[model samples]
Target: MSDLASPPLRRIQRIRHELHRRDLEVTRVERLSPHFVAITLHGDSLANFRSDSFDDHVKVFFDDTPGEPARRDYTPRSFNVQRLELTLEFALHGSGAASDWARQAAVGQRLVVAGPRGSMVIPVDYDWHLLIGDATALPAVHRRLEELPPEARVIALLQVDDAADRRLFPEQMQVQWVETTAELQAAVAALTLPEGEGFAWAAGEASAMAAVRPLLVAKGLTKEALKVAAYWKAGAEAFHETLEA
Candidate 1:
């Protein structure tokens, strides 16, 4: 057979690999903190999943019952795709499909997952950036700060559980940590924004974001200047949607 007419060897291998790689069981679960649960699954099939500098999330599959499908979006904490190992942190909210699953998830349980999908990657070249949100948006906020090159001015307003829930980020970054005891929206609203170029990114509760959206716009930020998402809702199940309105 002519070389051009024959099937490529690499293409053949990829097709074969695709047949075997799909989903795996939950092999391990670790409690990273009181508020977070890091569940690691075998990474053999997901070896190609790559983390971007900004935000990346996956559609986590769950079985709430027979014949009824339930799915929720989750962010990967860390992953070693080669080793088939990855971790996902779940904020224990005591409700929602994801939070409930993480609350009761155990080693040996099975889960179906798909995609790091697309990235909400925001470059740090802005004159200044504001990361405002509650606990749910921590993963995105942390990733953004770490990915930013040193000497870049950035500020984050994070509402977490006391000091224990506060995370350490870049040395040059300024953080305003609010305990979860206070209202999530009010905490972010109280921030004294330093006068400068601001590209704000906020996520977490939807209603709170609804209020804050225009507040930032009124402060001279353009309508498209902010990137906001609601990872979940107060009383809804598996609520995951963009809060751009």
Candidate 2:
């Protein structure tokens, strides 16, 4: 197959392990924005819960319907080790099992979450970090910004539909908030990268992120210094559909 027909290459090989499921309780729910919902879940069952990477995700099962439970994947945004409280943010898009749950999630609701199974665990020692993605990828990007060293230079190139969806980013970090448009690929192409070794991470629409890979490589990032994931596709029902290939 031609390069275009083959799967996109990744910088680091990911590791996986069998993950055990945990039952959780919804302790609180807050609307972070018009398009986002923040749900906090906690329980003693989370005594051994762990997710050490910015992009770690857990499978959430909900009983929105009468049949087999509906399932969705979500990033584990924050975990309070001391309190054993885990927070997960959901993007409220069109009606779906996950979106439906986030819209009406209330305190006392029981939820079952399983596995981050593994983590990528990108090192923070790089000269700089490049973060790019849409709203679906925001929680992970924000997690990176919050976890990285304050001195670490980060360039955020993000795309969101409404202004209300934008969150408060640090002043020191360079951020480019692009209104939802087709020019995102062009914007990434025009970035003036700083000197020294850098790492680039992006997640968004499949084809759009695929176009960013060669550009970062041409701008001095090696294949080992880049990580791009397709969080969703325009016409696909599930995000993992691409992973099956």
The candidate maximizing TM-score is 2
| lDDT string, candidate 1, 128-238, tens digits | 678888888887776677677787878777777646667778777887777752465665555555554556788877777777776665555554566677777787777
Clashing pairs in 1: 42-84, 43-84, 43-85, 44-84
Model 2 error, position 39 (Å): 0.1
Local distance difference test, each candidate: 0.68, 0.81
Show how many residue pairs clash in every candidate, following the order shown: 4, 0
Query: Tens digits of per-residue lDDT for model 2 on 178-239?
Result: 87636677788888877666778888888777777777766766556767888777876557
Q: What global local distance difference test value does model 2 have?
A: 0.81
Model 2, residue 72: what's the lDDT? 71
Candidate No. with top lDDT = 2
